[model samples]
Target: MSIMDASGLPATTPDSNQYSAIPTTPSFPPPSRRVSYVASPSLTSLASQLPSNLGRSRQVHDLVRALGLLQDEEQEGQGGRDGDEGRASSPPRATILPPLKVGRKEIGRFHDLDYVDALLSPKTVVSPTNSPTSSPSSSSQSSSDDEEESDSSSSPKRKRFKPDPTPTSNLSRKLLSLQKFGLLDDSPPFPSLAPYVLALAGAALRAAQSVKDGTSDVALCWDGGRHHGRREAASGFCYINDAVLVILSLLQQRISIPNPPLSDPQEEDDRPEKTRKPRILYLDFDVHHGDGVANAFLSPLSLPHPTSSTTTSTSSKPLPGTPQVVTLSIHHHAVGFFPSSSLSSLTAIDTPHPHTLSLPLQVGASASSLKRVWEDCVEKVRESWKPDWVVVCCGVDGMAGDGKGVWNLGASEEEGELGWCVRKVVDWKGGIRGKVLLGGGGYNHPNAARAFANFTSIALGRPPLDPRTPIPEEGIADEDWESFAPSFDLEVPVGNMRDLNSSDYLDDVCQTFAVLAERIRTI
Candidate 1:
């Protein structure tokens, strides 16, 4: 039943073409490479999710191999080949983090605090001027664009005496404590938030390293559902908000690798200013209000940025030419409609000055709500916060009928471009400029395959022009994607998709029919 659009392909039709224009406030890296975070178990499920962890790590490794992210250690050892594949003798390892068991339910953790802050407060805008009049200053900078790559051909074998320097020493231990011990949120005397701060900072450093070299242009990662989590405790599924960690990491890394002022002051004035934290347009379109992400920023910064520290000013104080790093999550209006508590309650900290609302829908929350939310958040924030890079927490549960909060009191078959819509906006934007990385999120096991496929589509566009399947050449005019009446669901329950000779309807939208030479060249 899928129909092609003016672009000659399946199009995700939203309620309206409201926020389709390119966002000026938000921006991500130039269509850098699209990296997929895949693991054996594609989706982020399982109590321990151990086996899946290894698979996810493999996804990272595979991309690295394909894009050559890491140095080739054995090019010389095994002839002068590229050593891109089939060079490893041992099996890959799983990143199975010990299942976070709280009572009977398996939970998730948030290793980074900044990510937590950003989620909770998406609209804390910052101007992109270097060494601005107001803000926190830092030191001990790491090499931002300075890195040396080992030659693939005769990379020397060194002793195992090398130590992997962690930005924060206690990070891994605390990650263990934060994950396994579970006492992290409460200000336990000795334990440090430093670990998570550094873990995320290290991640940012690594990403920066990746960018400095020609290794990676775009990166996608799904992490830390921390809305329910608090400064002192794990709420919902999050243990240590990793998003905050990344943000904080970038901040710390920026400090460590000090931003030496441009030699030319006029040059700095003349050119587009770079952000301390990659001006990231962190967009989350899941049905749930990316509450965790929104909360992080909204929550008063532990050590407030200068902007956070200053007296709140008028929105019209002449916006900055460039944007500093920021997070913006538009959600279904929750003021009086739902959550009972006023939206202000969630905005206890520094919620975006004027939070956007997706509002409860009339026809019981059709797919349009999803598209609206995406468009609105991007558009509203466009003038204020265009990111240098974008990170999308791809949560598929909101496709149609969702359980964990979409503001829809009831459920409905969210047909048409359900997940397709989310994929389209990000993918299309990526096609033009900036990169969009897919990070798995909030899903149950049975639905994992579809989620993985969606991510696959995002990474590799439109299913790679299926060679086996031919496009309809007859050019029927005007039927949209859902027009074919893809009658059957993924669970069509046995029998063939359609009886070609019987003149019966084709129940299965994705059905693969077998035909002889007669069906072919019939055009």
Candidate 2:
């Protein structure tokens, strides 16, 4: 069955032959506003080894391929368009690129050398004398471990082994070291942990490089977005904080703009070079707050500048005192949210880190609530900061049907839905030069695959797949078909959860962010 292209032309149908080998990474020319997907067999295989998201990487990849979203640019005419009809030009068909492994030096940029060494080492051993009496498993089992493991196994090159529940002597000491690094409870050291870290981290780095080098305007790395990883320790099933790494990489690339018209023509002779460090906006849409990323960039110096202070800017450009990077996380924050950091709370006017903002919502937030947040908070901050690059942690755990999620967010194309929010960022105008989309927490594997595949379609300048679209039987294994269950379609339907965000609460959110946005403009 063939589908109609956006130009009302007959488009290619999904055929068995379409599943050819992904092309090799090429020397990308100048930016064409194309979309590039970072993936490799090894990368996906290694990512599947993650205990928290076993086989999820491969599942997302397969669904994308099944949808024919990865077709070569040469195969289809660049006729499809997004947003306004007058926007005749559309991005070229999305391409797949192989990733380069992240080096130890790159990993050390944000993490301590000692922590980096322990993470990359094949085996970290401490003296038996320093051994602790308790083993790592003595703590409560991670919520992720409750999910049934997929029938699919890890890479053939690596052997999988569970951590020793009852350690003795030297092994006990090793467990103690792991605990110190926050790799014990929810995130345990598994076989080939080093390779997994390198692969997933490399994919995210490659996505950032593609955007920075003008290879693509938007880059997607479904295997990336480990936002819970920390500088010295791992948390929330994240071993490497790829989101932080991506931000740091983009921060180094300065933005070049022509000098604004001089307020006084007489001062033109004394004008300096018109360049400023690139500004990055890290927008996270996970169910849980992005504590790792917010903590990584936390700075007491991010407070708003005095009104009279004019250090450099004589024009309407951002003040030199403004932070180079700003992060805003929208998540469900209750009394005992998994990450109970002070940074996860709502942004106060006099907060030490004004640029590090959080918009916490109550249980059962729906599309309408998200719409309010987007219009009042997200867009307001984006306009004020005028970010050069946007790094989005698109965690689908907030979508309905997630065991751990409290929000009633859906993956439909309707206004205020998850897909709609993503499209808004993709189609953002003004100073946004590029975008990077990374995967995060999503427990239900089938639903995660469905949501990500839809997101990939949006990035490819195609309309979102109909929620009722049937799951293709071509490449799916017989035994895995049952995973889709009753409604084996693309839809992630909204549940019956009650939206507790009252108008008074939402009004307060808007009023609070209004003050913060003005403060950002002054900075």
In TM-score terms, which candidate is top?
2
Error of 2 at 179 (Å): 0.6
- Model 2 Cα lDDT, one tens digit per residue, 1-523: 2233442222324111232223323322222357888887567666777878887876777677766667453533332223234223332346677676677888888887788888888785322232232233543222221223244667233222244555554554576679879767688777768887877777888999999998778999988888888999989999889999999999989888687788787864666666778989999999999999999988656453445344524567554455778899999898887888888888886665668999998899999999998999999999988889999999999999998889999887788899998889888879788999998899988999999988887876565678998887655544344587889899998989999999999999989888788777766
The clash number for model 1 is 70
- True-structure RMSD, every candidate: 23.4, 9.3
- lDDT (10s digit) by residue, model 1, range 108-129: 1333344334322312211222
Off by over 4 Å in 2: 1-32, 72-92, 124-168, 259-273, 302-321
Model 1: residues with Cα > 4 Å off, grouped in runs: 1-214, 222-228, 250-278, 299-325, 330-352, 355-363, 401-418, 424-441, 464-523
What lDDT is reached at residue 443 by model 2? 90
